[model samples]
Target: MPLHPACECHTATRSYEFSESHAIRGSTIGMVLSKQAIPDISQNGGKHADFPGAKAPYVSKMKFLNEQSYDPIPIYRVIDNKGQVIDRTEEPRIDNETLLNMYKTMVQLNQMDEILIESQQQGRISMYLTNYGEEGIQVGSGAALLPRDMIFAQYRELGVLLYRGMTVTEIVNQCYGNHEDRDKGRQIPMHFGNKEKNIVTASSPLATQMPQAVGAAYAFKRAPNNERCVICYFGDGAASEGDAHAAFNFAATLQCPVILFCRNNGYAVWTPTNQQYRGDGIAARGLALGLHTIRVDGTDALAVYRAVERAREIAIQNKPVLIESMSYRVGLHSTADFSNNAFRSVEEIQKWAQEENPVEKLRLYLEGKGLWNSDIEKQFAKEARDIVLRTIQEADQKKKAHWKEMLKDVYYVMPQHLQKQMNQMEKHLEKYKEHYPLDQFQSE
Candidate 1:
């Protein structure tokens, strides 16, 4: 029987395809296009000085007489588990050495995370967040970016900063909370910031960095600088924040070159994905928001690198891309969490450690290619330990900063009110001089 032209039925022209089992690995849409069909400049609620002119390039010609309603969009990706390259077109043009470097960084990050957490437990630092499981997401994305292009990150992105040439000594100094710390001892340990690297200091507040990243990317797109894009890193938990949504709308509307990288590690602190949203993956959320999205196995370095490589290309072309890297948080959310917390079972952590270890995955890949062996692991561990221990030892010996540093860097010059406050505080301290000798306590 002939089916009606508009019928939802297949006839002689139907296509047949066989599918094999495939494992699926897995931020923002602007509000203007959804609400007004035409952009409402006033709908841009906050300070977007850099966004000038048409905000939505994809729908600049649309006309509407009513308030527009935009759909919640989900994101997209290219890589999968088992280290397979499923998207040939988006495959990165990288060498084996580059691949090896990515794996090495992942291993280094794992060791660093473990070492830092131990350091915190031993009273060496005030706080720490482990980048243990999300190593590939940061390392691969960081490697794909230009050195000069600014990167804004959340608290758990030491791998990215390290890949961008941050020294272990500097990391140790910051961890030690000494005056020599590049952040001037202003933040908690593992809180990253480097003006010279053009990497903005990470604030403890969640999601704030996302919008700033949008602004930075917008500047790069509008400025005379030769740089192409900016990459911002956040966690799946951050995806629920208002700032993340706001940043996406701003970036999409302005056609800013930015990549929103979300590490969907299955939990946000004590809350699991089942508790956060009904969606199966964050990529679908990004797609609903009208973003070009990608989902990949976050535990696979090659997959992450390839996805990020293509993301960078799209960002450079003045379009935004959002990547959701699906992985696990093998460690506690931070050093502060009780190891025995019921948020996750010990058995779950053990299961992931045995199977989803990204370092082990890459090591297996390397060994399969005959490029890795016991000697490589031994040498890498020895060097990493030696270097890390030396840096920490030196940092521990450095002088600490005075409380006055709390007021420093907050202004170009001390305002009159601050000057007066500083003087008053000094006077209050002078009264205690006879009770406690300053010379005896001065850090050297």
Candidate 2:
């Protein structure tokens, strides 16, 4: 139950000294840990980091210095809540299209989520997950990566697929599990992937993508002159999975080009983030593994992009980076999860809706810069809604997967045993013509 033995934060007063000559370039910007004997805290509990601008400015540093070796990772912020640029240096150098696209993507994500959620409720679609208040983390991080860099996603990464030009038709069809669905109705709603875009198939299992990303990145290194890294996404809850920790350690040890992006929205399902872990959030785990790590404001798209852009650079060189984006969800975890009905309050969700909507936060910045207007906003919303409706209409016409698909991809050549079983099924269906619908399995 203790932290990793190599977790320097487990000690007091981390004994680290900088060696400029041996340093990894472009890193070591702040608090580079060097190997040395740490001094005893011999003070108050000594289980926390002592940063310069810690929450307690009044308390003396020595009084709180504990056995904890790592400091709280500083949050990198560029924009404020009112959409003002607080740090000019950290601003991402993006063109107008890039800037406008960020706003457009967020709006589209919201619109699509709304329509799909309605469909799920109406029984038209099986399930859906809303980006809600965390659209910035979804769209921003997606824009930061190149087409070749792979994304191993958690379920909530619809923004990433939408940004990469996944159409409403494709998304709707997948959710509808119709004939046009890419996976041939194999996966449930929201678990989509594009082979051409280099995105991995999203599975429902928690924390599985992190380790997969590392292995994929390792394989990428062996490819012919391939210059790419893997970006894996998971939630605060998935970070608790043992696979996540194992992936972190392997990533650091193997020196793979992978960025483990953790969306620390402060909850893993119904459990509040406070109950998730005792140490610093997901970012600290990356530091404990000695990987270059960063914490950023998830509500600020530019900040998330900046962190990921730099992380991509480091990852391309076969160095892993972990990013923790602090944000909150306005809606429940998913269509099946009714956290508000049981554990959360309506007022709490409403509070985030008004104060922390990432889409609105980015919209405010764009409007303030004279890049957006109410007219444009209305157009964005209206067009997104129309497209989703049209997609749904077309998807409804498509039929389900054919019978051949049942046994098709399981093997290059249908094994004799499976072939025999299929033949027997066909005969049985023929015998029960009234009950069995052979045409449904035959073809669309």
Q: When superposed on Cα atoms, how far off is each prediction in RMSD?
A: 13.9, 10.5
Full-model lDDT, candidate 1: 0.74
TM-score per model over all chains = 0.79, 0.83
The digit string of per-residue lDDT tens for model 2 on 193-291 reads 999988899999999988999999889877736888899999999999999999999899889999999998877778999888887788888877879
Top model number, lDDT? 2
Q: lDDT (CA) for every model shown?
A: 0.74, 0.83
Compared with the true structure, what per-residue lDDT tens digits does model 1 show for residues 375-444? Answer: 9898987788778887788887776677577677778988988888888878988887686544422342
Best by TM-score: 2
Model 1 error, position 15 (Å): 45
Tell me the lDDT of model 2 at 320. 92
**C-alpha lDDT (0 to 100) for residue 224 of candidate 1:** 46
Model 2: per-residue Cα lDDT at residue 390: 88
Runs off by more than 4 Å, candidate 1: 1-91, 433-444
